[model samples]
Target: GIKGAFRTRIAYVVQTNGGQFPYELRVSDYDGYNQFVVHRSPQPLMSPAWSPDGSKLAYVTFESGRSALVIQTLANGAVRQVASFPRHNGAPAFSPDGS
Candidate 1:
């Protein structure tokens, strides 16, 4: 019951505009339909990885001028800033256990 709540479909971020200063993170079905924007930032998005069960996305972004790691839940569009350092933070990956 709880597990199925967020298991709608597979998701990944798509960037248009030639991956320039303005980029968009879009999520869609594995078949490239039912697409929607998960996040958008002026900076680039890097190191997007899915959780173990494929329900959440963990990614790195430069939206704050400095690199920061963010984890977003795909179901309700809830976002949390997980890692933010003084200078740099990038290349985020989720643990096998989804921690």
Candidate 2:
């Protein structure tokens, strides 16, 4: 089994200057190898939180021209909008049991 902080994975964002997709949510090993994009959009993305089982990620995206919360399943690259409201939505996090 994987143990220790050094073996854990990390999620982060990258700004791609002058690209079709300007913002990217990516995952990588603790040492920064095997990096890959989990999601990308012309709009901004922020606050990536991993599920308890590490099967999904909850984040905020501005694709709708306003902040919205979404969840992405890692296995199939499926995304679903979880929350959308007036003004702003940000700082997504998963519950301890991922419910």
Candidate 3:
């Protein structure tokens, strides 16, 4: 027997200007509904990439005079710093194996 299921969902991250704090990361649907903020820091955030499993996201944040790579989970809103460098660390791309 063959069993299958169908699911329709879409998500995207948006960046907005930051006054005294850093930029904000917002997620919305394809039809531009259910808009909500995901992350916000004292530094600018950019390049939000979703994981292959759609369970996590990798992005960059500039707070310590440099940019740092951070991975955030969408389930419980847990974030972890993955990598950091002395210079800019923007544009995070996930691998094929989801690393």
Candidate 4:
């Protein structure tokens, strides 16, 4: 069996057919319990990546009419902008050390 599987958690994205925030980022335990929406946006959300320590999540968003990268702190639901390039930006992932 996988080590520490019982404590594993996961993050995912869900797109609604129509809603104020059509894109939703969600998280849940390995067994699907304790599920909740982590973030929501009117634009598309993709690449849900958890920090190595599991305290934060990083993802791509187009909320500004341009693709950008953002990091969200799970504890306080605080979001910080990481990058927003001229044309586009995407695919956010934390370094091995969660930097």
lDDT comparing candidate 2 with the true structure: 0.88
Model 1's TM-score against the true structure: 0.72
Which candidate has the top score in lDDT? 2
Instruction: Estimate, for each residue in 7-96, the C-alpha lDDT of model 3 and write its tens digit.
Output: 223434444565665467766665657767788777668888877777777888776567899988988999999889776777897785
RMSD in Å for model 2: 2.3
Candidate 1: C-alpha RMSD after superposition: 4.1
lDDT string, candidate 1, 22-91, tens digits = 6777766666778888888777787777777777888888888889999999778788999998887877
Candidate 2: give the clashing pairs: none
* Predicted structure with the largest TM-score when compared to the true one: 2
lDDT of 2 at 43: 93
Candidate 3, residue 11: how far the Cα is off, in Å? 6.0
Q: List pairs with backbone clashes in candidate 4.
A: none
Q: Give lDDT: candidate 3, residue 15.
A: 48
lDDT of 4: 0.86
Candidates 1 and 3, the one with greater TM-score: 3
lDDT, candidate 2, 1-99, per-residue tens: 534322488889999887899999999998899899999899999999888788898899999999999999988999999999999898888777677
- Residue-by-residue lDDT tens digits, candidate 4, 1-97: 3333226888889998997998999999988898999998998999988887788999998998899899999999999999998987877877776
Cα distance off (Å), candidate 4, residue 92: 1.1
Prediction-by-prediction clash tally? 0, 0, 0, 0
Off by over 4 Å in 2: 1-7
Give me the displacement of residue 46 in model 1, in angstroms.
1.5
**TM match of model 4 to true structure:** 0.88
- In model 3, where is the ten-residue run with the lowest total lDDT? 1-10
- What is the lDDT, from 0 to 100, of the residue 54 in candidate 2? 85
